[model samples]
Target: MLALPTLSSNGITLKPLTLSNATDLAEACQDGELWKINETSVPEPDKVMDYINTAASMPDRQAFVVIDDLTGKAIGSTSFHDILPFVKRLEIGYTWYAKSYWRTHVNTTCKLMLLTYIFETLEYQTVGWRTNIGNHRSQQAIERLGAKKDGVIRGNRVCRNGVISDTVMYSLIKSEWLPVKLELTKKLNDAH
Candidate 1:
């Protein structure tokens, strides 16, 4: 059976990706600043529909559209992918925020909600995060989440742009989550 895909907290909501979401998905991908840090280009409408269809059909990929509760608009995307049931592990990836929402409460709320769902709801023992080594912004965000820096995987994978990037890895184990989550929550709640 498939795990039901919906998670919400405070005013943030995460819902499963759908073909109807292509327009917002494309808009989220418009900012070149975000694209520079990501490995894949934000797809065109037709391409986004393909992404939605393919992702929804994938048994292991639990993709969600990050929606702002107040405005009810799609602002970004995130997913629990590379899930390994036997090992009780999952990877939080393919995350991108609309440029306007960057460094806002929205981002923090989203991360906190996702972590809560992953470690508490899904009972995942470990959650992994990785980014292209050249993407310092992403590296900083991962570290800020209290994820321990694991070694980088050299020539880890090729980007959609056809360039190979060494991926810097980070992870948080369940044993380490409570305190870390507490700290992150505090930081996210505090005035920035």
Candidate 2:
């Protein structure tokens, strides 16, 4: 099993998600009733435990709760899923934040942290992202992080609303990391 260490920077932290995070996760999800969204994997308030348990049992996934450093609150969640250590690759998905955090520096900071850790510390060669094809916001966010659109997967998976959705794929290989990292860093620095 892969162990995820707590990572923090730029006023946010990503800590390994645990069953104990049920309350925080529920509260975060309630911010915009995120579970009502058909495309995301966010669990309803009553399903938080099941969500965490499932995440814990998944050998290929390491989930993290996004915490706001100054407020010490769990504001969102993201994960390193579809791990393939043999190929030094993984996908970053199952991510969502309270609606309030949208359009802020949080997403960019988290991406920078995760990408740096994967490319530099873990020496992972590729990081990929997948989103519901209808989720334009998510696609934009992933693209802004410098991931190239790989293509689409038809009938990828059943969404929360029980609809089979097409998945839009994106990726960033190691060779593309340095410039992306620099751009992300510059964005974060320029934000202040």
TM-score of each: 0.89, 0.98
Worst 10 residues of 1 by lDDT: 37-46
- Residue 135 displacement (Å), model 1: 0.9
Name model 2 segments beyond 4 Å from true.
none
lDDT of 1 by residue, 27-135 (tens): 7766444555446434543466777777788778788888878888777788788889889898888788787877777766777888888788878899998888887
Question: With candidate 2 superimposed using the best TM-score fit, by how many Å does residue 50's alpha carbon deviate from the native?
Answer: 0.9
| lDDT (0 to 1) per candidate | 0.78, 0.93
How many residue pairs collide in each prediction?
A: 0, 0
Task: Name the best candidate (by TM-score).
Answer: 2
Task: Report lDDT (Cα) of residue 152, candidate 1.
Answer: 89
lDDT (Cα, tens digit) per residue for candidate 2, span 1-192: 566888999999999998878898899999999999898988999999999999888888999999999988888889999999999999999999998999899999999999999999999999999999999999999999999999999997898778888999999999999999999999999999
- Model 1, total clashes: 0
lDDT of 2: 0.93
Identify the runs in model 1 with alpha carbons over 4 angstroms from their true place: 31-33, 36-41, 44-46
Candidate 2: give its CA RMSD in angstroms.
0.8
